[model samples]
Each structure stands twice: as structure tokens, then as C-alpha cells.
Target: MLPYKNPELPVEDRVTDLLDRMTLPEKAALICHSRMTAGPIGDLPGDLFPSSEELISERGITHFAMMAVPDPVTMATWNNHVQDLAAATRLGIPVTLSSDPRHGWASNPATAHSGGGFSAGPEPIGLAATDDPDLVREFAAMASAELRAVGIRVAFHPMADLATEPRWARISGTFGEDADRAVRMIEAYIAGMQGGTGIGPDSVACMVKHFPGNGPQAGGEDPHFAYGRDAVYPGGMFEHHLRPFDAALAAGSAQVMTCYSIARGIGVREVGASFNRELLTGLLRGRFGFDGVVCTDFNVVTGMEIPGVVSLPPRDWGVEDLDDVAKTALVLNAGADQLGGESDPGLVLAAVSSGAVPAERIDEAVRRILRDKFRLGLFENPYVDVDAAAKLVGASRGRELGRRVQARSLVGLKSAAAPVAPARIYVENIDPVIAAGYGEIVSAPEDADLALVRLKAPYDKREGLLESAFHAGSLEFPAEEIDRLRTIAERVPLAVEVYLDRPAVLTPIAEFATVLAGGFGADDDLALDVLTGRAVPPGVLPFDLPRSQRAVEESRADVPFDTADPLYRCGHRCPRA
Candidate 1:
């Protein structure tokens, strides 16, 4: 009944069966890219690994990252379907379903891999708050089980960057401020994610991220954009950043993701880490001895963000925005073994024909991709039970885990107005019944003795040309919101909670709103507890809120956050008595 083959054969044999007959185009498609892009799903109209599998069968792509994968059931169904498709091919090459770390409940975009609807688990800050490596690993192991259940063999997660300054909001996603803490927690996380027999065929492969550190984005901000461009360490604190990577490498992580955040005047991100030879082959593969697959961060390629006007539907074959071949060459030369986004294999095939990249290079990348597949034994026991999807994915255990992380990761920064928790609480946005438990929640800010306002603070650092060109012409809060806050402040002790991801310029809270509290990825009760003092507010300041734009512009890149000595410090905490 299986298309790929009977699950009994060794994965190597299965792969070899498929590998021998492929043409260059099929192979190029396999090794270069994977996606969750728009398209109908189902193994390439009955091809292995979804729509592309048939092409690979006709040609030679033994390795490819799986995409469009739904929840656990869909994941298993798709994976099994891929294996079946492989069996139908002469080679019956099995594919590995990889994921962004989908644990507790939050789907981290930071990954190309994930099982959707994951619990909103605790991030690095929460893990750090626990200060328990065992707990960290426990979360990892649980995540591993969830991933493994859905037939995901690889997990792209366990970010281990050291939180260097207050400006970096990404710190919430990492373990903590100290390098040692990050290293230790990462070790535990890997152990947990790897699951069971340590390093055996059944373990989930852990892909540690943003190698060589990406935490100290200049100005305590993310380098996702031009203004946040490149990581700089004039402090020479670069070595500290490398510690986690070293630990992960030493621990034998299955893969490493190159950071999109560029470092200094070094390397090229016009193509990103996939094209950074200094980063890929030189440092990770060579110096670190990382034999595993090295991949690029999402949509980092030159042509990925091309103008829509140039690209037409159904392969209309029109004039384009970027030269695909040149970008492909850069990726290959930079030692990238895979591609991200809507990269077509036609370009690689063209390159091969034109002698731009030797056929040997294609083979090199293809073989590596296949070899990893061989190593994972995907060829054998490829199809997972559609039922296993239900069993492991939405288990109550995962939800509990997420809830716990949400609790621990709650970082209580500043609270000026006295904490207030009336059993009957009123909120403008939350549901009433839901309010009854936290207190009788309300729909309007004006009615309650205590008003809880949820505000989303700034996160991404200055990037995009538009962003760089952005000038803060004035500091102003919304008049109505401010007026509302002032009114609420008058009626009752107001609790203004913000989903603070980055250090914000807290200009004049509208006098109406009183009692300010904020932290990254806040859970409702976590905010409530911090207000009621039911839970001690253990969150600390990861970045400082500057009072003015002039001070931000004058600051040096790579300098620690709070450089201007704003209103907060690293350890500033407001705990319940």
C-alpha cells in the first residue's frame, strides 16, 4: 500500500534507489529549498515530500525540507505520504519532516519547522527565571516528544544568545543575561529535545540557532532592518557570545542556523548567512566541526523580496526584479547547502549548464542533504501513524507546559501606581465570563474600578530603508486613549499593561491611565498576578526606556543598552511584599 516502499528497508538503500536515476534539475530542487508558500498540498500530485517529490523521483534529490505540513495529524499524514511517494519512485527515497521549534504552544517564526498551535511556552527569560537547567531540559524533552510524535525528526530551536544589553528585546526569547546560564540551559534544552537514548536513531535532531551570537545588535535593537543593521562588538565581548555555540557544537547539535543579523563590516547579507563562507564553511563547518546541515534564516536571499510587478502568476515568464542566477551563485559559493523561500531549481540547472557552478558543487550539496537523510533513517519507517498525530500533539501536558513558561517568563519591569486587583475587574477588550475568574472582567474602561489596558510596544529595531529614514518628529500618545487612561486613573487604581518587546519611549502616559506594568509575551494572569501581588513580580529590565530620541541617535552601536542611564536598570524589579 505504501508508495515509497515497505518501511522495512534501510533508509540508505531507499535513498540510493532514488538517487541513482535523477537528472540535475530534480536534485537541485531538493537540496536548495523548502517552503510553506502558497500552493495546493499533497505530495506533488502523488510525489514524495509533497508536490516536488515526483520531480525528485524522476531525477536525483535525496534530501529536502518538508513544508505546508499542518498539525500533528496532517504532519504524520504528509510525512507518511511523502514516504509512500518515495516508495512509488524507483528509489523510494524517504524525506525528513523538519520544523521550527513548536513547543508548549507558540509557533516561533524563528523556525522553518513547527507543529502549528503549539503552546505559548516560556521563552528564554522565563527559563532563566526558573534558574533550573532540569526544568529547561524538561521543556525540551517535552517539545521533542511533541515534534517526534508528528514525525518531525529535526527541531530548529533552543536559541542561546546572551542578553548583552537592555536595548535588545529579543532577550525575552533567550535564556538570560549571563553567557554561562545560556550555555548551561542550552545544554539542558538540547538534552531534553534530543529525547531518550541521547544520540541514537530515534532522537529528534536539535538545530541550535544564530551561531556566533546575534544578541548585541547595535543599540540594543534587532538588526532585522538597516538601522538595526549588523551586530557590532567594539567592546570585544564577541567571545562571550560564542560560548553557547561552542557548547552546542560540543554537545553535537544536529544543525545550526546562520543569523540574518549581520556582524560588523564582515561577510555579505545581500545574500545572508547562507552565502557567508567565512561563517559557514570557515567557522561553523571547519572550526567548529559541525558535520550537520547548515541552513539560512528565512527569506534572506536576494531575490526573495522581489517586486510583485516583475513576477507574474502561473510562471508567466516575464521580466524580473533580481537576477536569480547571481544570487544562486552567491549562496552556493558561500557554502550554503540549502535555499529558502520561493527559489526555483531551474536556476541551479541553468547554472550547471552555463558552467557557473560545477555540477560537482550541486552534487556536493545534494549528497550532503541525502547523507543527512540517510543518517536519520527516514528511508525506514517513514510513514507515521495518522493517529499518533492526535496522541502527542494536543496533549494536556503540552498546554500545562506552555502555561508554566508564560508564568515564569513574565518579567515585571516598572509599576508606578499602586498594584490593584479587584475580584470584579473590568477590561475594555477581554470577555466577561473569562473576567469572572480573574475577577468579573468588563468590556469598557469607563465602568470598572480598575481598568486594564493592553498596549503593544515597539519590537523590531530600525531596518528597512523606510525605517532608517524615519524621524521621530514628536512624542505623543493618543488623545482619546490618554483621556480614557486619565478618567480610569480617577475612578480606580488603573493597571496599564503593555506587551513590551522593545524598550519604548514612555512619553507621558495619558494622565487618565494609572498603574503601569509591562513585560514581553505577557499571559493575562501573569499581568494580573503582578498587579494583585498574588505572584511576585520577578521580571527585570532587559532594556532601558530612553526619554528622548536625541539620546538614542547619539548612542554608539554595540554599546550596552541603558547607555543613557534612563529610568530603568537591569535588575530593577517590583516584587509583591
Candidate 2:
């Protein structure tokens, strides 16, 4: 290893000098870290988030990405930690803190800063439903302010994946099932988050994700967990998926993330795009000509080791069949700028020392990281106010837009006026305060004479996102919980609204309820409109809902739900007359 000497040099020189000094262990350490992993110096949880102090340290770690934390103040604390770390680090390198996209109040750890009270504003489906480009831009810009105010610089969001399947759990999180809509929203999303020029001292950078089309996963399963492998684009039909990434680059997406799922038979290891050359260099850099920071989707390397103990299907990609050293080699060769999750940087250093990877490659990655910090003005000034970080959260203009988007994205599946006799309504899982804004907010389903029964929740069961993440699949409802819903539906003409995340069967409610609606996210306004017969359902089934595990398996890969003899054909929206 070379000696470290260029202390006063520019970012580029310092990066080169720093790389020259680091041993393999230290370099590998830079690439891997657990989200919110509490190390000796910082205090955090084990959900793959990072502390601010860890970011600014001169310990040769520049890329700091955090996932799965769901709070704003906690997020603020995390950012403040980064700022302090930057100030205290020997090199004073302000950490480039990045998130998956917490635009809405969902505060999904993937996108938003982790912790309490962070708003999970609305799902991306809401933006596409509005079909208003200008509005989309406004929303993005608003969201940018919100993100920046909280001390985060980059957003790992605007998932450009075309939601072509109804069964895909990540669909509600995307723009929609259309490529064009996704592309347009990508532009708007990037513009909103990255465009505001220190306007009122707020503006978050954007990171367009799941590059080169992650929508084609054989089944609707997300690549994040196991079982969700094979993103087959059959004969380069993948052009549609690339559209959004192109548009995002043109619109100035500061950074781009790789997909964890496997792509067709090509990179069968389910290796993330972060380490895929076809995705990073061939497509993004070679074709699109994007010269920005390139980071991996979180914990991708470590994820390969996961055996996906969390995901349902026990599976293995072909890469695991190859030599372990070669596997990590492929990722580094693929052009990943920075490693993600709690990966060990040792893989990267070993690849370098053993001559599997060229020193130039590692240097290039470091350059990109430095370039981003430079652009962010971190080199000039890398600190943020702590008090301000807390104040700015949930105060951005994008929050309302999130609600509107959620309302607009809703698609009424089943609505019936059959034997109907009521002007008002009420429900659980919904705050009457939020409900009243859209329509009647009642406290009693029985008193209303007609019940618009909507399951306003993430899953049909009450398992939280964190719990479900670990559970993977095999998710089921307890008998006590099922009994309560059964009794209520049987007594009233229930308008059963269901949130279609994974394949949630509502045979119980269907037995007694009058209506069933999918895609019930946070806001109930849009669902409310559909129930009241104000908004006609235009949503098509993104994927087929398998009645049984056997059906889900037997279904075709491209179009999983065959219309010939499927439980629910694609585009099967039961509209009101």
C-alpha cells in the first residue's frame, strides 16, 4: 500500500492519495455496513441504517447509505450524526447520506430516514393516477424541500419500474404499470427533489433506482428478498424499463441505484445491478452517458449471503454455484461505485490485491464518490444545523401532495348499490379526522345504515412492515382477528376495500361484504370517492392474484395470470354502473 500524503490537495487528489494509503481490509470496510448498525462509536439499530458520525470520519468510508428506518426525528438525528462525524473526522469528508425514498408518510426505511414520526407521505402509484405532469413536477419539488430540510441530500426513489403486474408487492410503491407514465413521473420526481436551488435553503438530491428494468422479475416477488429472481425481458423488450432511467439522467438524478433481483438468465446470481456492467456501464454510462454517483441498492453483497432466511421461497441463484471469490469479483467488475448494506469492504480490497480487479476500478469508484460530495458542496461546507433538521421534517409542501397522490391512485375493484340504503359511513383503521376530508367520517359502521368497509392497512393482517419483512411470506391471520372482521361484514353491507400488497385473499370478507377494492394505501380519500360512486375505477389488475399457491406456481412467467382460466384476469376491475 502507498503512503497517504496529499492532505491539502483537492478532492480528486485527496481521493487518490487516500486510496493509495488504505489496506485491503479498510477499503473493503468502506463498501459494507449494516443499516443503523450500532458500532463502537455510534448508537443505532440493526435495520441497515447509518449514523452521521460514521459518515464524516476519515476512516476511508465515503458512501453512507441507510435503509429501513421509519421515523423523521430519528432520521434527523441520523443526519445530525453524519454532520458531526464530518466535522470531527480527520479529513472532514461530509458523509453523503442517502435514503430509498420516504416521500410519503409511509416513511418506508428504504426511502425515508429511519426512526419515529417520519411521514410515509403517499405511494408512487398516487402520482401516476393524477396523470398530471405539471402536478407531478410540483410534487417532486415539494418533496425535495422536505427531504433537504431534514439534512438528507440524496433520495433513493422514483422507482421507475413499470408496474406491469397486479401481484407485485412493490407495485403500489412505483409510479404505475405504464412505461411512459413512469418515465414522466421520473422526470417530475427528479425535478422536484433536485431542482429547487437552495430556495429557502431546502432541496434534496434524487437517486433513480432499480436500473435497466427490474419490473420483469419472473414472478411479482421483489428481488430484495429471495425467491424473487429472474427479471426476464425476453429479447431485449427491456427498452421500456430503461426509459425512466434515461429521463432521470436528463433531468439530473444525482445518483442511480442497482437492482438486487436477478435479470433474466444473464446475471442469474440475482446479483444487484450495482455490480452489473450491463446496467452500470453498458446502459447507464455507455448508452445514457450519465456521469454521476453510482451506488448499490442496500446490503446487496450481504444479501447474497442472506440465504434469504427471511424470504419465503428457499432459493439460490446460479452465481452461488460459482466460486465465492469469483462472485464478488463479478460485482466489482460490473462497475458498482459503492457497496451497499452491511457488506464487508474486504471483498473489494481482496479483489484489488489479488489482481482480480484493477486498481483503476477502485480509484474510479472513489472519484465518483468524491465528485458527488464535491457537487453537494460538501467539500466547501459539510455541516448542517441539528435543530433545523428536526424542524424541517414533515413541514415540507410535499406532505399534502402525498395525500392527494394516494387518493388519486386508488382503483375501486368492487362497488355495489345492491340493496343499498345509506347516505353516511364510518370505519376502523382510519382516523375520522382524515376520513371526513373526503366524505362522511362515522364512528359506528352499524349506525350509518350502510357500511363502506375498507381494510385501511398495509397487510390484511396486522403484522407491521418490520415484522412482515422478516416473516417474508407464510403470512397468515390469527383466528381471533379473522373472527372480528367476519362478524362485522356479516352484519352490514360492507364495501370491503383491500390493500393489495402481496396476494391477500379475502374469502371471509368476500363471503359477506358487498364490495372489494385493492391498493388501499395510506389516504382513504380516493377509495372513499370510488365507494361513493364519484370516481369510476380505471385501474387494471397489475398482476394476477392466485387463489392458491399451486395457481401462482403454475401461472406463466411473463403474464403470470392467464386470462383463459385464472381466478382474476388482468384488468378485471369491477366498476359501478
Candidate 3:
């Protein structure tokens, strides 16, 4: 047996032996990660989407981006099956499975896959609202264990991007607006996922994402769309956004995922972070001393015409004219170790042969990839027990922790006289069965002593295809909705809670509601717990609530807390009596 095949050998020696034995195609495969579905194992026919067997045997791929987390038994079974295929390959390089954050409350399929059997928790914003670094760490640790239980070794999470820009569609996935606070949260997050011992076999390596920070998008548009590609800095505060990433690196994040947005007007080249060598190589690598693997955000190398997403266009931002091969070359030259959302190694293989990208560059990328696999102890035993996985995922302790954290994340923006215990209650957008536990389920506002209304933070509705799904555009609530909320307040004492995906203009509703609350991806029970005084409202505003849309428009996109006369400042919360 080769040295790489010997589990007792030092990881460095094993990695070297593996790299030496790998073919050019195999090396290329290591540097790119393609998407994989979790379910009963079957072949997915596409150039980009291939079955686990095809990915290992034919393509020589060793990394996969996973989604739609199935039951733990199914996931573990599928993972073990994939491992078996890799075991049959020449090098037997085990697959490093990765997934977006799965436990978030406002889980966008684009951002976080469903929780499946895992404990569902608040979004990053909600967790940050609690202002508890220890809680964040606990959640990350629990999430890490759940991820590892199902045979996933990588957590593409702790999205350290600051929610500086209020309208950015991805803000719900972020820690919040303050750089200092975000840095602290990020450090705790990395430590939790990687563990105190650092990223070893027991740990699920965290990919601190959208490096250099993905906040500060121009007009609050996300980079997933061609129209939203340029991430501008009108206040010239680009370095301010780097605080969290810098802290994350110091905390020893195992990987960095570059964003799709191009840094415009920052004296840097106007190219996507994936295509910009200066940002990826010079700033992140040279200046910041990040030696970890840098993976590109999804679909940077190829054009994707997603069904029902005609409006987004392709995410090729700066190098739109480049062919797939050239795009692959550019991404590699920019120092990205892996092409996320891309499966086909042929483009990279062609680029190397044509001398568009050097073989040494590919070798360098593969070394980092292989080292991570070795560090994860995948070479020793890549398989997991399905029965064990079933028991571990969504374990009772994790669910209890999740529940406590959820209750702690509720921020009371305003406080009023508490409704008497067992008072008649009218609830909207809440499960009636759950509301019944709190009080009598009244049929009308007139019959209720208190009306509880839950609203999503306002977004300007977009037209046609893809834009409609994102919570972007305007931040103001519709007039009719506000009027209705006001009417309810007139009839009965009202408690209004906003599910804040982004900072909303809430002056209208705030004026009318007797009590105001805000949270991110919280369950009805948690909110009710806080409302009924069963749990204290321990959360504070993670980011400032702007007074109006005009303030949001006038504020610099790159700076936190820049909105004029914010209705409620960061850290503001109504005190418990």
C-alpha cells in the first residue's frame, strides 16, 4: 500500500504522497466543488450535477456542496455510499461535504438549506440580538455536532458579513451592523464550530464567508444578480467591513469563501472578488495572512440560467465575456482554491493544458484541499453509522438549547401594560393551536383583549421571475397594512412583532402598536414566551432601526449606524419591569 493509504502516517506525508500520485485531472477535481443532493442515491445527469459514483470514479472530484438535508439515516447512508466509491478510486481521496447554514429561522434555500432533522435556531441577526457570544458559540458547537453526525465535515457558515447595508437581501444571514460586535461574534462562532482544540477530526471546519465582508452593496442589491454585482463604498469605509474577516482569520477559520460582488470605487480593480487577484491574492492572502483554502461563491465560473430566475441573469459580474475555460483560469489565478457550484473538471483541465493556468497553481490549490481532508481524518475512516446519526441529529439537548436561545433573541422595541393572564387574544400569522396555550383564541379584534400581529420587515415587491423572491427594494410597509394595524390597535391593545429580515421603516406601526417587538426567524412559542413574561426579552437591536426610507437612501452604504435619527439605536431594548 502507498504511504497515502496508510492511516498511521503523518497527515503531511500522506498529503504529499497523495498529491504525487494524483493525475492532472484528479488534482483539478480536488480544486472544484460541485453541488450534490441528499436522498436515496441515484445518478444526477448533467455536466454540472453528477452522481456521487460519477464524481468520484470518472470526474475524480473530492468536494461536494450539499442541500435539502434528508433524514440522518438517509444522509449517513448516502455519505457512506459516496465514501465507498472514493475508496474504490486510485487515490481514495475522501469527499469533503459542505453545506450552507441549515438551522436559521428565515432560511432561504439559496442561503441555508432546510434544517431537516437538526435543531432550528434564530438567524444570525437574532442570535446577535441576544448579544451573547457564549450563546453563539454554544449554537455553533451544537450545529457542528449535528453536521458531523450526518457525515458532513465542513460548515459553510458563520456568515461574518456585517449587515451594514439595510436593504441587502442577505442581511438576515449576517451577524449585524457593528464591526466590533461582529468580530466578537465571529470569533466565538469559529471557536464553537472548530472547537477549542481547533479544526481537527472531531471538528466541522467553518468557511467564514463572503470574505472582505459582503455588506455595503450599492442600492442594497445582492450580487447574485447581474444588476447587483457592484459592491460600492461611498463613505470609503472598505476596511471597516474587513474587521470580522480579520478577526475570523485570527480565530483560525479553516476556509474563506469570496463573494460575487465587485468592489467598486475603492481604488481596486472593478472585478468580482472571485475574479480579482488583488483582492483574493493581495489583500486576503498577502496582507491578512490567510493561509486557509479560499473558495469562490457559487456559480462564478459558469453562467446559470435558473428556472423562474430570468431576472438575475448570470453571476459572471466583471468577466462576462470570458468563456468557461478563461473564467476558470481567472478564478484559479485569483488564488481561489475551489470553484464552488461547479462540477466539471474539464474546463480547469483544458485551461491547464492550454497554459492559461499553470499546473503549479492547480497543485497549490489541491495541496490545501488535500490537507483539509487529511486534517478532517477522512483518510482514516470516512464512513459513519446511520443509526448513530439518527440518534445524534435533533437530539433533545440541542432542541432545548435552541428554544432557550430563540426566546432570548426577542427584542422589545416598545413596552406597554401586559395583558392579564388568560386574557382573550387575537393572533395573526401564528399557529392557532400554539396561541390557544397563551390565552383564549378570540375570533375578532373586538372580542380580544390583546391582538398579536406578526409582520415581515417590509420589502418593495419586485416583478416577474427571480427578483420577487428576494427581500430587497423598499423598506416601508404598505399604507393599507399600516392602516389595518392602526385599526386593530384602536379596537384592542396590540402587540406587533416584526420578523426583521432587514431594518424596516416602522414609525407607522410603532406609533399605533401598544408594544413593539423584533426578531429574526423566531418561533411563535418563543415570542409568546417573552410576551407572556415566561421568559425575559433579553435581546437588543443588533442594528439601528432607521427612521425612514429617506434616511436609508441618504446613508452611506459602507458605514454602519450612519442612518440619520434612527428610531432605535443599536443595543436598544425595552427593559423588563
Best by lDDT: 3
**Could you give candidate 1's per-residue lDDT for residues 139-250 as a string of tens digits?**
7777777767767787667777776554554655676565666777788888887753234456788767776677777665554444454577776666667888999877
Residue-level lDDT tens digits of model 3 in 531-556: 55565577878999999999999999
lDDT of 2 at 326: 62
Give the CA lDDT, 0 to 100, for residue 392 in model 3.
86
Instruction: Indicate the worst ten consecutive residues by lDDT in candidate 1.
Output: 311-320
> Model 2: which ten-residue window has the lowest total lDDT?
306-315
lDDT of 3 at 260: 91
TM per candidate: 0.77, 0.75, 0.97
**Of the candidates shown, which would achieve the greatest TM-score relative to the real structure?**
3
Tens-digit per-residue lDDT, 272-372, candidate 2: 56556777787788888876666666655544332323432212243555444565667668877766664455567667778898877776666666555
lDDT of each: 0.59, 0.57, 0.85
Q: What value does the lDDT take at residue 20 in candidate 2?
A: 67
**Candidate 3 minimal-lDDT segment of 10 residues:** 305-314
**Considering lDDT, which of the candidate structures 1 and 2 is the better prediction for this target?**
1
